[model samples]
Target chain A: MKIIITVVGNDKVGIVAAVSQKLSELQVNIIDMSQTLMHGSFTMMLMGELNAEADFASIKKELSTVGEQIGVSIHVENQELFDAMQNI
Target chain B: METKQIRDTIAMIDEQHLDIRTITMGISLLDCIDSDSHKACEKIYDKITRCAENLVPVAEELENEYGVPIVNKRITVTPISLIAAAATDTDSYVEYAVTMERAAASLGVDLIGGFSALVQKGYQSGDRKLIASIPDALMATSRVCSSVNVGSTKTGINMDAVAEVGEMVKALADKSPLKCMNFVAFANAVEDNPFMAGGFHGVGEADCVINVGISGPGVVKRALEKVRGKSFDIVSETIKKTAFKVTRIGQLIGTQASERLNVPFGIVDLSLAPTPAPGDSVAEILEEIGLESVGAPGTTAGLAMLNDAVKKGGIMACEHVGGLSGAFIPVSEDAGMIKAAENGNLNIEKLEAMTAVCSVGLDMIAVPGKTTASTISAILADEAAIGVINNKTTAIRVIPVPGKDVGEEIDFGGLFGRAPIMRVNQSSPAAFIGRGGHIPAPIHSFKN
Candidate 1:
């Protein structure tokens, strides 16, 4: 029900707005988000709830297309799994 | 309640080879040792179990909250040899090892370090016994680790002890070569390194602590990959920049953890330590940094530059910088290092030379067990000599694998990995090792 979509790759204008529009269209509420420029590369973390009907695969596939269009790579993972990475 | 910008930063690191290497719980065992060895062992087991009980769940919770991967949750205790010193016989070592193993197993920790001795000058009876029992002690336990500091700058080198430990290591290797993977010998060794078999809680540490080792050879490599064919100065700049970001994350997390755990936060070791995994080799970073191949001529100089630059950058990034906080090049642990050794481009001698400039000495190297203890001692003496002279921390995790010769392989499985049996200088340096005494502190050590 909850997903974190990370959009990273080339620094460009409207990257955030574009992703936000996609989430708005999908009716996914953006719970939290943050972005920063590290080492001149643009990185972003977006936490949002995916509509229950929208499975992860479809969301990922759609984001992949959007990512390809923008010349950046995108990844979507479960919030639970994302949190586990911090344990190390 | 995540902000718009935080989400974006997380997206960039995905599938990009960022993960927390370990979440180690530092437990003080000083309260455990008793005049009676059996009682001491019991106290050790009980203390470790109680302190580490919440480690896994707490780490899991932190992992969830922070969105960073924590690969291991481990426990580090006061040096086992110190606690086991009350033993009248060898069983104390075994009993202590077994108890530590059982306690670690209960806490679900994969391995525990500090099954160790801190004999920089000469051996105490307990230290001697612990060294002698290492082979059987390690062979009998699954998760226990052992370390001994045969020499130190303040104490010079203890050649005789180094030689004997070498022989004992050979015997240990002979018993179960894999178990040899769990021991380390050191110079100016730290008490709070989370990575092992070299890591051990030192006499200087608090009752419960956490040390963070942040590694990013891949991140460094990726940064270098961008500036391929750049000048050495540019490469240095790129490395410093990348190290800053990597260390910032460690500093943030370490501070947060120290505050939450209510223990004094220790250091953030900014070593670019590598695993056997691909794209994670510190040596590869060198090659990427303009070396034709690792272990080539000038390799040590290159490493010295890299190691120094990392410390400079890291010290600037974090207030509490400790541990073996230079680039680590353990031969068996990094695939790139193993490849270098396999290709004959890297040898024990060159590795030792590199350690003088980097963090930790002769780590995870497998030497021929049959070699005279004197030779092993010589190796230890030589490494300690460097540390003492330079007044820097260095260590040796040499495994004289039994029955394995130069170029042969000894597989220890998992993170310990397989070491290509490296050659030892056949010449015996026993006469030198036999004359053991304190090597007084270096002039540099007087700067305090």
Candidate 2:
């Protein structure tokens, strides 16, 4: 199933690089992503699909550790709902 | 997929704020009924729980897959009063409300609606019980909302039911002021409005259905912002064009969903609705359409022009344009309006005057707690007069916040937003409201 990961935290170096590396390692393909800086805070919305052979739990744990290293929060939501929200 | 189109769509979505206004699943509980009220309540609870068990997960999946925000996943069941008609006492109604609240909590929904009674022409035995129990039902529950339809195009106005609602509003507000905030009295309340308290599963609906409410006030406002010095015609055209794009998106999504859910698609309600944000204001659209100010003398005429154009464009965009399909100017929900009200420009009277030409009436307005039931009824009467006279839909959602007076602010959190307490004429119109007979159908209502 596809998933959306919302990365919200301080504007800093290496956030995109770190998140991309983890997803790539887990074999998840990044379908689309956008980053915006609103009122001095960084927010990112990412759409990606899970790798068939990858373990969801392990990837989430790895993402969390990355989140802790950068003082950010990571949230993953199913993509069908994301699309429905956009469409509706 | 066409790579170029996909790239363009992604680019268009990149800079915008998009979120699901609501994902309302309509469930018909008629099949859950039996001769016994107790057994009927159990089946009703089970059926709602079972249908909504996976709604959250499925919604979350869709959210992640598309990178869009699914803000609310709610359910609108068959009106509880209809299913609980077999009850011998008011306790069954309360029991049903409690059961629905519990089921919603189990399903992780924020609110559950359809605690309704259709008493347009007159009240039935069950409708009376349901109406009388509204104060207790609303005060007792945390997430259940109640609505009553007291007038319609065909029935004109039901004075008895309307008077009863006035008292019900007072009792509900007194019980736990917030409960009163959840009650809505409507003239032509829609069956498939995805927006709150009044939405319900009409008899014409499927065993279950999904209706969508698409909002784009920010987009429309920004479009207007582009033409600051443009002529009134161009500004009106801009608003209509933007509304068309938004409605088209809703049409596409609604059709896909109805097809996927294996149910017929309902209407795409093109309400130029607003949130509490600074930029998302339907009133601002009126201002853009050449009104010197939103609550000024020319405001009604401006709204008439805007409302007519929106309908014209939206009707051409979709075959089914139902619900309260017009511009909504809920004062508390629109930041621009709240500011206007706080400044002495917008008041309850002017807002009601503007409703002469708009869609919903006197929405999200907060008056002083001391305002009597008669005055509230008077406001409802005045709005109903406009509706009956003009032959359109109108409604009242007033919150008499206890201990709060004019110029004070009451925060309702979330989508209900916050309202800056508006001034109510301390002078009572008790004499007018006491003349309790039906204001004979406005002469225009006799088109038959």
Candidate 3:
């Protein structure tokens, strides 16, 4: 299954690096990435292909921990939700 | 993969309360009927538990898998009256309700509906028995919701049944006003409704089906805010676009849940169901459409536009749309409506008028305990007239809180919310309600 991880908070160095490292460690492959700075607040969206054996709950918890350490808010959601709401 | 679309979807879920309101499994209990009441009750329990064992888990899995919250997992069965009719030994159908409550509790479902009877024209023996047992049944069971269809477009209104249910509602409240919250009286009740306390598996439905009800009052309100001060055309267009997105999500979730449960997918009820939570209110949506408040003048016109636009936008998004497919105005369940009522801007009379243009009528309203059954019957008659003449679905789920007066409030907690006991007109309608006969179908019902 694919999931979208959105990060939004104050702009800081290595925001993408921190999030990407956490995903890689969990064996989740990055499929797409987008980053923008809006009024000095950093926003990034990462699409990742989750491994079959990975624990979704643990991965989400670990990502939130990483996000907290880096001063950002992280949200993980299935891509189908966005596709369903927008494509139709 | 567009950033804008992703952000929009996220905002809808995270900020606006876009949610699949309920995923109700309708299970027909015709085959469970037996001559012996005890055996019938056993079969009923077995059938419900066996069919709905996986409903909660499956709904939760879908909620996690699709990243959209499914607020309620519920069950609706063939109206217990039909099943109880076969049991010659029983004078009451309270056992049927008890068995349903057990099944619901065992399955971890939020509520189980269809403890109901349809007597739009007149009552049968079974309907009479079921109606007689409602007060006790509802008072005894926590999760078993009940409804009675006392009127319809083709058959007119069953004034006798309406009168009985009005007294039944009072009796229910006298036992426990909260129990009245679980009961509804409907005009033109739909068979596949996923919303409660009015959902039931109609006699015409399949043995088992899955129906989805979607909710997004917050999304519509937010969209209307964006078009603030715009013309009606822009406002309507914005609402339609937002409703399309909400219904599409409902369809997606419904299809996925049906496939997982291996149940036939029924209709998607595209209702903007509201909660007491901030920002998730149908009244707020109405206010956003240029009304000063939900019950203020021009509210009916605003609601009519919203109801029509939602149907227009949602019809294309799903294969089938049924249930009460419009904006619901349940006062206690909506923060804005509750506030409007508290501030004296919204009253029972205005709400009765609003029902002609909205989805349901006098929903989740609270009246003083001193209110008489005849007055309640009069209210039902008025609402039923609106639905019957207009050929729409209208219902009443008013609670007459026992020992509570006009200024007092009843806190049902959770999604049932808190209700301020609004004053009812003291004028007696005893003579009108006591004339118990069928209100004949309207002239417009001759569509042929």
Better of 2 and 3 by TM-score: 3
The better-scoring model by TM-score among 1 and 3 is 3
lDDT of 1 by residue, B150-237 (tens): 7666667666667777778767766776776688888777777887777888777888988887877777788778898878888788
Model 1, B191: alpha-carbon shift in Å?
A: 2.2
Q: Which segments of model 2 are wrong by more than 4 Å?
A: A1-88, B1-16, B89-92, B259-264, B288-293, B312-319, B440-448
Worst 10 residues of 2 chain B by lDDT: B1-10
Q: In candidate 2, what fraction of native interface contacts survive?
A: 0.13
How well does each candidate superpose onto the true structure, as a TM-score?
0.83, 0.82, 0.97
Most TM-score-accurate candidate? 3
Off by over 4 Å in 1: A1-4, A7-88, B1-16, B87-91, B437-448
lDDT of 2 by residue, B8-57 (tens): 23332343333446667788888976667778889988998887677666
lDDT of 3 by residue, B62-141 (tens): 88766689999999999988889888997999999999999999999999999999999887779999999999998889
Residue B133, model 1: Cα distance from true site in angstroms? 2.5
CAPRI tier of model 1: incorrect
- Name the candidate, 1 or 3, with the larger lDDT value: 3
lDDT of 1 at B390: 84
